[model samples]
Target: MKKQKATIHDIAEKLKITASTVSRALNDNPRISEATKKKVLKIAKQLNYQPNHIASALRSGKSRLIGVIVPTANRNFFSSVIRGIEEIANSLNYKIIISQSYDEFDKEVQTVEALLNARVDGIIASIGKATENFDHFEKIMNKGIPLVLFDRISNELEVSQVVIDDYLGAYQTVDHLIQNGCKRIVHFTSTQRINIYKERKRGYEDALKDHGLTVDPELIVYSNMQLEDGRKKMEEILKKKISFDGVFSASDYAIMGAMQVLKEHGYKIPEQVKLAGFGNEPFTSFTEPAITTVDQKSIPMGKITAETFFELLNSPNTDTVAKKTILKPELIIRDSSK
Candidate 1:
């Protein structure tokens, strides 16, 4: 309206250089001399030069945009992870595209395909529950762009991953319940296919074995980790008369459901039956007789995943070799558990 904005051509004209040289200098390409870079930067600042990132991505191979896929965006864990990722990414002048797979396989495939077609510089994801086949992930790796996974990952693919110490978290929670004198510990779990749930199950089983407690299959219940599943499983436990004194759940939602059922049945929490859950979700702390839970270090895990993706961008040998990073989880004691 007032005046036209300065272009690379304008900067070149002012500095008596080619537009290509101006472009390189603006981008800080090493080929451009230091003196030229300083000059271009100084003049660009004066002109208030705003580089078109999308246009530049088309011209060059880098979009400075990373795609992030998670099982659900609404979940607190994934939302916190996204925050951490954005913190690092924003500092590096990059942006992210987010997609939710809804824990479905076909949706995951479509999400990956969309991100790929968008020509993202990198992708970070947590595998969905139904994502048994990894051909969609392989396509991303084949594209030679960095694909870093976090939280939920596949054992089959060789990819960079950042995850919590699920086994340790589970083990510690169970140990605490046992130390509080709960002899019969019941585990409320998701499917065995998910690596996080699998690790949690192993930890629960191993913790019982370590403490010389009987490993009772009757005490273990698979509920797909849904709220309704938790409620039904709790009822099922009562009907079966398995005689459990403690409950450890793979998810907070499930534990909350279990708590509801327990309260309805007039069972005293911690005094009679103890409860613990994974994920230090916001609701866990606010609920009546606050829940004891394992903090997954979600924010830090997300930052680490984004950092790993950036590291691969500068690496000399670009192979899809698996790089693993695991973080310790802390157990938070609360009124729900003794």
Candidate 2:
């Protein structure tokens, strides 16, 4: 009813050679003569022989494949990071599988399981915003799979991580606003309890304290940091008649929303109320008053993430110490904050 697929043994029998010699010839092994390799290839083609990569990987114990997980693949930052990862991986004769979590907790756990089942040699990921319990990630370490995290990471997991210095970025932004005579500044942050936001908030408070500005509860607004969330929070702040000369948001999208609301309220940027945002999204530069922001060095972050993953993957020691790579953030001054 069904035809049998051709194997190395089939080609070997036709050429009167051993199966091992045929296998070596098919693989282009240096031990096989060029004449023998060409004959084996010809016979393989005639017999319709197909090599099973999965079986070969199982035998060798290396898939030469890496899995990469991100919150979303549509963002320029995330896409750029992936590009950097691909450059290094392709050069090393390895390929990558990408998965998006969409910032959901359950989706992240399920994706981790799927990648593991796919038999990826290692995994590189950025934790989702909704993820708090890291049991899934712990499972990876328990199974002895190399896991590398970048950008959005957890302190609870003792895995290798690559991230920019969020605290310094926030501090520089607030200090820049203060230098530009922006007193009574309002800060927009998230209550997600992620290290990035927490670090940014800490930097914001420290800058205010160091500059003789009291941290006012009314000036601090916490939200999801989306564009719509930014507008709603900004509107609520204005409704309370809060006096603020500057606005610094942890997200560029949120700051853009705040800018729209401020414009609608007849407030001129920089002249009336200085504005700044973190994460130098491309849209930040396109705004009427280009927003001052921090560059997270996505390309470098991705390259370093991949490099760290390879380090763990190649290590012979099972109990290798976890490492953390922190990149410096660059403060991009723009018209919005000038």
How do all models score by TM-score?
Answer: 0.85, 0.89
The lDDT values for all models are 0.91, 0.91
Estimate, for each residue in 189-301, the C-alpha lDDT of model 2 and write its tens digit.
98655888989999999999999999998898998888999999889988988899999999998999999999999999889999999999999999989999999999998
Candidate 1: where are CA atoms >4 Å away? 1-55
**Stretches of model 2 off by over 4 angstroms after superposition:** 1-28, 32-53
- Provide the clashing-pair count of each candidate structure: 0, 0
- Residue pairs of candidate 1 with colliding backbone atoms: none
lDDT of 1 by residue, 1-338 (tens): 69887788888888999999999998889998999999999888888788876678889978888999999999899999999999999999999999999999999999998887787898999998887889998998887888899999878889988999999999999999999999999999877888999999999999999999999998888877878989999998887777888999999999999999999999999899999999999999998899999999989998998889889876879864679999999999999996
Q: 130, model 1: CA deviation in Å? A: 0.8
